[model samples]
Target chain A: MRMLRLLTVIMLLFSVAPTITAQETITVDFYFPTATATITNPEAGESIEAVFNRYAAAFEAANPGVQINVVYTGSYTDTRNTIQTEIAGGGAGPDVAVMLTTDLFSFIEEGTILPVQDFIDTMPDGEAYVADFFPAFLLNSLDEEGVIWSIPYQRSTPVLYYNVEQFAEAGFDAPPRNRQELAEMAQALTLPDGQRWGVWLPTEGFPIWLFSAFVIADGQHFVEESPSEVYFNTPQTREALDYIISLSRDYGVMPGGTLSWGDGPSIFTSGKASMLFHTTGSLTRILNEAPFEVGVAFLPSGTAGEDGTGYGAPTGGGNLYLFANSTPEEQAAAWAWIQFLSSPEIQSDWGAATGYVAARRSAWELDPLASLVARRPQYAVARDQLAFAQKEFSAYRTIDIQGIINSTLSGIISGATTDIEGALTTAQAQIDSLLAEYR
Target chain B: MRHHNALGSRVADAVTTLLSLLWLSPLIFAILLSFRPPNEPITNGNIFFGSTITLDNYRAAWSVAPWLTHYLNSIIFVVGVLIVQLVTVTMAGYAFARMRFRGRDTLLLIILLQLMIPSGVLIVQNFATIRTLNLFDTHIALMLPYWGSAFGLLLMRQTFREIPFELEEAARIDGASLWQVLRHVYIPLSIPAYTAFALVSISSHWNEFLWPFIVTRSESVRPLTVGLSKLVATTDVGALYNQLMAGTLLVIAPLVILFMFFQRRFIESFARSGLK
Candidate 1:
């Protein structure tokens, strides 16, 4: 009698289970990293996580039978490490992740990420969608064959942040236009007794980004379209290096040793440094924290281009990558989430909130960003500089190659090695060997 | 000679005080920074004190992550690991110290060899094992890999061997079963060793980040370290040191309180167990 009762319960459970399973929601796990913990929408006052949740909620509401599980993976490095571990463990990692734009080659080599071009090709407005993003921001997202591997989300370029009061006091009506003027103004603004320096070019953690600007302004591409090629030891690159070293050693306007990247904002805002070479992602913070009026401009150029401004910068930030490890349904859902994030409306709100440059050119025409740029024109400087911006230095085995370049730059700048050409040549050889496998 | 001895002692005390202050400087800075007003950064010549102390950093840090769930998950993870570790380590320690068996030394040597292997290299394999067991993203998955601690086993074995063998013999002669002998004789006398091992196990596991981060996906299973990491901004954007410090204080407060409450016992246990 007990066995019969158990059999009846089992039969009932089987009948009910399939109906429940039939209505199951497809979950797309989305992982992202924030620029800072305190990222808040200035208008709505929503926290970063709350903003993400709101987007997910909106997306879910639009597309029924799909759920977006947003995970706050730490920094870009941590997110990459987590995904790598997940893949190694034979588990499908997050359906989508926000990784560094330079991480494109490594992920491509790993075969873990699916090219978004596959999804784009199927869309009716694919060409228009691809054309809408800022060309500079999309530079790092494309491969040698020009296939789009990722979608630009949080993007930024390094801009010159100068103290307005200091610039005025030093009798400067405008920010420096060229390297000579930059040094002259920096020297004039500098105070004696080490009280204040003219400029603080942070060299401690990844100095390659700003340094690449110098290389670009001097009419040399830092890295070619090929993943295995880099122009680290070129004459233009050497001239850029010598000019940077002279700013500290001969000009006595910048710091002498390895200036910490983490200290740049505070050092500028605190009036310890008159000008700062830092990311536009830090624009909001610097503007908010500066007691004096903050001035933002393009980084001084080494040589003028055809457009008549030698001004150049390298775009640096994260992009949305879709993993190949998901189901077709999940991939479609993930692609939709990426589009929703990169859409003009959302991008404008995100840019105003977090100080990242909106990847889409159309996002600038939207309300919050348009009004904000109107109120504070510093926001437009990064946008204008994008015309002269180039891809951040990226190659096969990017992290290791970046490490070599960073250490070599640090060595020369810190006076550990006065042989700038020799050090860079060695670094170039090391990078070549590391990239030889890819070639 | 008496005067000279007093002078030497005075110098020693002064040196110790200097060393202690040096060691405490970073903590002092963190505490000071945590309370500093968000507008007044240390670079503004406010290294020690800002114009007005505020809880804004704490408030901002608190709102960023789910701290309550993180604390609960951390407690469950550390306590769970410690409880199982005590059982396994005690039994293994007893077997190695008192039992007679073939290849006992060889088995013990192999187990001890795990102490030399860095836990980082085992992350992928352990993660695979966890996935195979269908335990990923669970609290048990966070604690599973640490259950059998080689260091704990080795510490317990050394501690057990130092005990007088006559105590165990006497208990056995009195018709005490192996379980009774262990419970009444070995365990009670090995309180200091057990306490020492427990502190080491709990603190290390509590502060663990990589394994928990790799294994868990939900806020319900992630620990405090993972939560603390959310406060770290990317290097490009300069750090918000004030909020980072505040978040750190929140994550470490429980450990600090535990250590303070058990200060005397912890010191005595370490001393008695011959562990630094």
Candidate 2:
């Protein structure tokens, strides 16, 4: 499966290893998740891996003596754990890798990744490159010290997806704008006798990000932006969880069970639910499979009587990171590769290939993206939602902290527990201990 | 046989058939689901059989991942791990079963202790060890941790012990060397145990995902289970049940085919292994 890549690596090591002149062959390993195992499953053309390979070749050819090994590490967490394990073992991982932006603090604590600010300070025109991306997309990348730790890559957000035909049948011309209307509309849409429900909030899959949308809608950051603290026991978190649980318990709008994350979109597309909340990453799946018209909207806002801006989503997905352990030349090469990958041209291509939102502001101006948005329009919803997006919920011990909150939310929403405040308190306790060292 | 006994035997056979079908239902269901067209959402009814059946999902699954590469990697990993384990376990089992040595019982106790310690519990240390050895991103990394298998050693020891002492004695008296006696006598007679161990080792390594996933940085070294995982990564297409099932069926196809071809031998080996 990796014979081609391995040969390239070997030839690259040979080509660069012995070079003795001013061209000090910078060998950089760029780790990112591949959408397919297609080095084995090589498709016809323009697959995500193909695009990256093309970029790697272009970068290598464009910069003589700089070789890029584009390694397809399995997933975001897989890459993070791989790097962390290596770091813990007194070794360096990939020169550059795609780290989950939510894992910014964990990576910072490990002291394994060089802040992008370091790269920017040394690289030419790096300021403009940093500024080119949508500011909302950079919110998670920036730390309290204002060091940019990462660059957005394949970012996404959750959105409200509804069956437009069902909406029309229910006499609604537009999607719900706030929590109250959503409840009322969901009640009207649900027909248990007809074997259909109103709405379903997937209990398990990326529940932390999904809950972030809820907490944001209620007008509170789920955790402090400094990544030093959490606000899980606040009114916002409780109100959000209660509202989620109430849909099943109080309003009877959604079913009371942990609807598997994998089944969420299919449940909607199958006409089992009129509306579902999920990542905009799923836009293609919904559009292709829906038997009827579908509409995409920002997740409805909370009933906080806000100025039409209470709704927000967590900016989700991986970020490009430079490993701290790489040599100056390799780091410089990594920075160059990052710049090439993050350019508006590639970002737009990436967004189109995968349903991730284009991370750069300028990407929307590109032709196919512009035309695609004009036609499908739903493709634009995740981008539009970015305006209201907060940096995704992040803290020290990011995964475990979120796991605590997700289990609490899932438990309450699924009727496994009635104590929202108590669950939040337990989660808060566990996280507090986990982050105590940082504090 | 008496009528009652015959009737009871027939009834037991029916029950066993029903249980086997129940056990096999998940595999059957996955295969059936793989035949579904992508447009069709999986439902309770679709589990029986879909209204619209197509091999489109299989084509899509095959085109999306390199199952052949995964198949090759899996074979390499399984065979590599097993070959190493066989040599190590056989020698260790011979020493424990026949030769007298100090701390033998204590050593056996320690080996058995590993059987109690879940492989997952050692993942962090093993990962650290792998990284330290600079074996990350290689198939050897996947094999290193399992090379000294405690269960295999124990299974071999039990099998060697079960071989009549008179056989080893006969070989030794015939002027066979220690290695020769063990090889000619113990190894030859432990066919069923060897088969059982081979079966267990192959399937276990074939199905292993987590450790291999953690170790492998690229597709060349990753096996079918890891490749199948990419199918479910379903970043956007959510579950894509048809495609997922298709990929899963393809991953286990080699094993299933092996089982089908070697069903009698497999059952016979296990039955004769004295496993109980």
Candidate 3:
């Protein structure tokens, strides 16, 4: 009796399997980082997974015979690691994944990603679609040959956050516009005996990020279109490094040694630091947590340009990339899913819900975000700063190169290495050797 | 001599207390931070008592992930791994300790060599094997690679060697079967070693992140560490330390409580087994 029952079940499975394959739905395994895990919409009170599920449901509803499996890969680093491991193991990874913008070169070098340009070329409004993105946000998405590899999604830039009441108390009606004024303002706002520092420009962890702002403001960028080159030992970068060290050692506005990136916002909110150089993604959190009024402004310029705008910031965020290990139909569905997520309306909603700057220009013209920005103008500062934003330092061996730069900067700033020029020169030499293969 | 010994003991007590406090500081900080008001910064008035304590962080952290499902998955994962590890290590240990076979020492040497390689380096190969086995995104995949622990096998083999051969001989003389003699004699004598290995295996697998995160996709299969990871935002976003600490506490609460309950027994087992 048991044998007969098992035989019937096996026969049933054999009959159903063929039909299931005949009408198989195209399933796109969408792996995304939990970048927005902490972001919650106050009005809707929806959790992060809920928001993701809603989007997936909407996309699937619009396109029949297609399914989206949303996998919450931990962080940007974890998502990239998972994908790399899967691809190296000869398994089909996620059909689509959101990874750090700086991962473009490595992914391309590994040949694991499908260039989204291939899909964009087939679109009727492809040119306009590509043009709609902020150029700063797209800076890291393109390869050296000018082929697009990814689409910008959650993006951000560092901005100057000041204590409004402290500025008023110091008799400053406006935020600093130049480096000199910034130094003076920070000094005035600072209290004696370490009660409060003038500013908390964090130089720990990835110090090169905020340091890039200073280098760019001084009329140079550390990296260019070439993935194998970096200008780490340039006069501009040295001056920037010197200026950052002087902020603590000479000007006595910031604490000596390396300040932690994780502690900046809390220090600012608690009035232990008067001004903070932090990502705009923390704007909402700061605005809510701060007891005093908060003010946002462009990072003060080191060298004023002809347009009276020398402000520069490095864009930092993740981008959507289509993986290569998928069927053509699945790839098409994944591309459509990407398009839906990056569409103007979705971007606007996403920007408003989280504090991330919307990558698309038209997203700011839409509802929730437009209204929110109108009420609180601080949201627009990062977007406006994009006009001077540069690509984040990325290269073929980005992680190893970043380690060299970060450790060099940390060593100099922390007073462990006083010879900035010599250290940077050595770093440049080391980076050259590392990137020689790519060249 | 008595006075001198008393002074020496007192000094040792002081040192031990200091060392224990050093170890406990992070947990202490986490406890304080988890109870802190959500918006209150640690740099306020006092680091410890900066603001009025509240349950808000716990409330918020609890809602971020499905803790119940994660708890179930974690329990299933650790228990499942421990069970399989116990059976395999016991059988393999007996074979190496007592059973005579061709090239036994060579095979034992090969198994012991795995202890030198870090598990992280084997992720690619293990993941491929799991994929081939069609166990991706399942709890079994999360537990499979860990089932044959080289450290446990070696420890068990050494432990079985330490047991008196007279005990097994007595059991065999009483007409006990091979399985009965091994089970009632060798197993009973090596309880301390088994307990130590069980604790080591359970805690390590409980806290594992990268392997489980790579293998499982759904919440139904992912462990508590993956759930805890959801509370961490990318570098672009600021850290929410209060809620993060709260989420961490929620994830590790079970293991911490279990250890507290079995604290005495754990120490005794480790002491007897000469394992730490």
> What would the per-residue lDDT of candidate 1 be over residues B1-276, giving only the tens digit for each residue?
999999999999999999999998988999999998766668545488788889988998898888999999999999999999999999999999999999999999999999999999999999999999999999999999999999999998998899899998999899999999999989999999999999999899988998998898888789999888878864656878888999999998999899999999999999999999
lDDT of 3 by residue, A1-439 (tens): 9999999999999999988975678889989887658657666577767777889999989998899998998988899899989888878999988889999988888889999999999999999999999999998998889999999998889999999898899898898887777888899988998999999999997899999999888878889899988888988887787788778887889999999887788889988989999998888778878889999999988765535578788999889999888989899999999999999999998888878899999999998899999998999999999998999889889999999999999998888997877898899999999989887
Model 3: residue A131 alpha-carbon error in angstroms? 1.9
Q: Write the per-residue lDDT of candidate 1 for residues A279-313, one digit (tens) a residue.
A: 99888878877899999988988765535567778
Docking class of 3: medium
The regions of model 2 sitting more than 4 angstroms off are: A1-24, A34-46, A305-307, B124-136
Q: Which stretches of candidate 1 lie over 4 Å from their true place?
A: A1-11, A14-19, A305-307, B43-46
Models ranked on TM-score: 1, 3, 2
Displacement of the residue A396 alpha carbon in candidate 1, Å: 1.5
Rank order by DockQ, top first? Answer: 1, 3, 2
Question: What are the lDDT scores of the predictions, listed in order?
Answer: 0.89, 0.81, 0.88
What does the lDDT read for residue A376 in candidate 2? Answer: 84
Error (Å) of candidate 2 at residue A17 is 8.3
What's chain A's TM-score in each predicted model?
0.95, 0.89, 0.95
lDDT at A427, model 2: 80
Choose 2 or 3, whichever is better by lDDT. Answer: 3
Chain B, TM-score, each prediction? 0.97, 0.95, 0.96
